[model samples]
Target: MGSVDKNPVPYCIVALMVVMMALSYGIQSADAQVITYRIHSDIFTELQDRYPEHAEDYWSSVKKAIRDGINAWIEVNPDLVVTPSHDERHNLLIEWIDSERVWGVEYHDRSLGYRIGIDFDSPEPDEYGASLLNPDIIKYVVAHEMGHVLGMGHSSDENHLMHGVENPKPKNIFDSKGYVVPHLSITDYRNIGGTQLDVSFHLQGYNVHDVAVVDINGTQYLVASTGNEGLHVLDMSNPDQPGLMDMDDSPSTDVWPLEGQPHIVQMYSDGFRVWSLSDPANIILLETVSHNSILDATLIYVDDTPLLVMVSKGLIQQYDLSDPHDARKSGAHHDNFNLLGVEDIHGVVRDSGSTYVLVDATFDGIQPYLIQPDKNPARVWHSFDQVEYYDHIQRIIEIDGSTYRITSTHDQIELYSVKPKIEPSDEDPETELIGHLLGYTVLGVDILEVGDSVYAVVATGPDGILGIHVGDKGAGKWTVG
Candidate 1:
């Protein structure tokens, strides 16, 4: 037996065969790209030769570990199709190695593609008798190695599984939810909102800037844009257990998934892009519209016409998006109206089932507009509440037949009942604040409906993701999960 260090060491590699059960999971969809893995023969032979007494247990544990690792990735991205492969271009190769040091090694071989080598020899348990070969520990190691296969480099965070060190203690890896938090990221289950709902999950270490949800056919998905790292598409078909379905590793700041269509308009610093998600596993870039002043945008359907509404320096512009590959300017609303210094636009959302649009213009507050047939929109109202500097108006969703706007500013989120002044009125339509929650900076937000309850999932920069139950205690109220 050799002592293991915090880093991978050079060792002689001996391929050993192993008999294992490799479960294959498939995604039934059109022209979907699938990631395949092959189990090398070295595993069973190495385990049987090294520890014949526990060879069966070792083989079973190793098999389960691989399955568990793949499953974890599927949970985060549901669009992934990882199945057993017996071909030339296997994405991953799993094998057993008789190594003196290191529990596992993930290396790329020209002929083998990506390969993972697990140690066949188990190290002596610590004083507490916690062996390195424990089933849960092995699963965690395999999951960490899988992260490398998925193109994630070693994380500097010591609490992360990709930190390059394998701590054999189970207590440090698993949380009360029975979830392998270390393998994913440190997730805080404590209540962070007023609703008392548990924070479902967190993609720690990633600076998530914005999120949007869309329904494809009968399935629902959420798109999370993390700026330069790219965008993540998560399947929300099972609201309680959202699975990551796909990811586009392109720089993105905001994403708006088109309604009743498998397309999304993603906005970056200087421009925006259109993507087709017909094949969630293989997201295709359809078009890019570059504008130096373009800050943020959203897709809205006026009557039956699909329009791309964008905000810039001091103007709100509309483009015809009937043809997703090409965008042509149709209408423009200059800032000469009621808008005040509209320099920074964080987000835009159309009031549900209405012709009104709400813009989250930081410092300027919420700006409401009425869509017209001639392409030019009319500014209905502009008001600022001097409580704090507003960042973004997350969404304007309909709950219990009432339209409510969710807005975030600094370190707090507020829900307000929005009534657009469609008809000429003496008193402005009720834009009254219902309830608010004070917390960390909430950069982006989206909603999920489970049965009769509505959950608001938010991206809190470094705080990761948190879930809130809308109207949990009663109507017009929120509770943190």
Candidate 2:
């Protein structure tokens, strides 16, 4: 339903097709302009059929909570959200079904709308099944189930409401007593789930400037910027208490890694500083690109050719590092943005053969620019609408096929699964809302995958650095970790 003039539509704009079992498995792209849900008569009839002995007021309370849950999300997002007529079936449906196996099942119908089924037969015997009438917890349950409809996966962080399983242990935000109720975590706001654990470490008692994680041999090290104190390399084998490895003696503005190649790190300060990690314990500066005050940079590989793309104030420059030592300029684009004085830009990520260029807080919130290196190498797709309420964009990371937008507004990060745009085309690829997480004072982010797990390393401004495990959200395994 959403389209762009010169701007390309984002994958999350239109709802993708979902089967009834999509929730049990997974679904994508439910970001319709207006998503509505109605309490199906089947749910009322199910209550009327089996629980005829219960008071009518009890069922009414449960129904209200479900509606309240949907309304709560509407208030949080920028979209026009509403509930349809009492008798009308809408984009999303909430119903009660006879299923003793599970308490709730969230899925999408053939129309590509979502439906959440609250099992009337089972009230969660292990976790206060009878407390379904408690609207507060019920509201949380609705929100959790609704998150999947919005295209969110389970959160690895147990503190988030999207935790897949029940936690008997008491946590700061989760209430396992009775029905499991968890606080709704702040996310991207296109709307998505998945809890994130914030693991932090000190950078020589300094407020960390920026951080990058690189694996050398079998050891992983954190190359972090310490203001003017130069670079501090920390041993991240134990991510909790990172031990300092070495320092660059000269500080850098930011850091990035060359894709596929290990031990090779890029630091940007007055210009680009390349380093070699032949020794995991020590890092050596290899070459320097004299371009001054580079805002952001990303590394891309086409065939075996390595391309280093950097964005400055007014122009985006590309360099071909066919020879790592003898670097050469390959291509450059001066007129990338139509908006004037656009300077809050932060990050660039590449996924599925496409390079996504991102800009933050430019009238519209953070949006993705899908750039493909085709015959012309200039094929780019502009990202979709913005949440008018949020702040500027901070960082953006694209992994697997998912795009994460870290925004300045409320320190929120939004997750969206972008349809594979292997090549550039006028027909905009659709994206679905994966979920969101709120990180306070988030300055930078780096997402890395090693085997079955994924990790997100965030650079918080004053609070220091945070090491987060993004959880196995994509794996359909939703047990509370």
Winning model by TM-score: 1
Q: Give the alpha carbon lDDT tens digit for every residue of 1-481 in model 2.
A: 1111221111121111110112432344543556656777776666666567664765787778777666656655545466665655566767664444443454554663566666533322111212333444455567666656766555444445444533222334433222222235222221112433333333335666677777777566777776677777777766656787778767665666665555454555666767876675677767778887576666656555676666666566667766656677777666445423445444555444555556552654444544433322252554434312222233445654555544433455444545667677524455664544443455656654454556666666655665555544457545577
What TM-score does structure 2 among the candidates reach?
0.45
TM-score of 1: 0.47
Worst ten-residue run, lDDT, model 2? 11-20
lDDT of 2 at 334: 65
TM-score of each: 0.47, 0.45
After best superposition, candidate 1 residue 35: deviation in angstroms? 56
